[model samples]
Target: MFMTTDVTDLAAVRAEHVRHIATTLRDVRGPLIPILHAVQEDLGHVDQADVPVIADVLNLSVAEVHGVVTFYRDFRRAPGGRTTVRVCQAEACQAVGAEALGEHAKRRTGVGFGATTSDGAVTLDEVFCLGNCALGPAVQVGDRLHGRVTPARLDALLGEAR
Candidate 1:
């Protein structure tokens, strides 16, 4: 059974919801990652409230489940903004002023990485790579990717997202 809780309701992660997710995927080999992904996909973030429920259902300790959640950058502990802006911070991107661009983004949006804007319009994230190494300073605005991005280009992207 899918969670009846609203998708945007991070705190609505009920034990039954986690139980359903865990039970459905339990038979799979090494099910932790997949289950976590499913939960995030469904709930926007892996609420800490659901960790113990998942652990109990999967017969694992809460620490194990929490460890996996914390270890992976893909899992968010809080609700993300309506839009996600990921800046490539890998060596290649950094070589081309990505660091400066990242700073500009944070300053412009008034939020650090892993934080959402005050208006809830955007979430700033740092990504190690976007595989567009040839075009350093790559960035992704929602589903679309751009390369060789400057601070101005990032501003346009954020504007569009807003």
Candidate 2:
């Protein structure tokens, strides 16, 4: 069976999680990044409502916490898909047809970079490098990295993700 939480109840629960994370890590040196990372790890993304709670714990302004969250691409402002598909776009990968593969992925997924699929199956992202230059045209599906991927291969991968 499926259960639905009221929006306000969800918000309250998220706030409590954020507050707990912030308070737990506030004493560490340069706590903001760790706190943010922990929040994202535990709750998917850093909700806008989390900023003030974190700021208050760390004795900073909401603007300060918000700045850290917004400045980093690694930090997602909203929930992403269950699977993250990252295509390397560095010079090496680009030299080996990454651009075309990326285009194909966008067309197939019907979502642009930084956006998740409507069904929340996959999120497509472009990364500068995955450190697999020797095998250019690398694509990372979640934590696993693949190299020398063709469009057909990518389709297979997406099919698995779906």
* lDDT of every predicted structure (CA atoms): 0.90, 0.93
Candidate maximizing lDDT: 2
- For candidate 1, the per-residue lDDT at 23 reads 92
lDDT of 2 by residue, 43-129 (tens): 988889899999999999999888999999989989999999999988999999999999999999999988899999999999999
**TM per candidate:** 0.86, 0.93
Clashes of each: 0, 0
Judge candidate 1 at residue 118 and give its lDDT: 87
C-alpha lDDT (0 to 100) for residue 124 of candidate 1: 97
State model 1's lDDT: 0.90
Per-residue lDDT of model 1, residues 1-162, tens digit only: 775766656445455777799899999999999999998887778888889888987899999999999999999998899899999999999889999999999999999998999898999999999999998899998778899898898999999999
Residue runs of model 1 more than 4 Å from their true location after superposition: 1-13
How far in Å is the alpha carbon of 32 misplaced in model 1?
A: 0.6
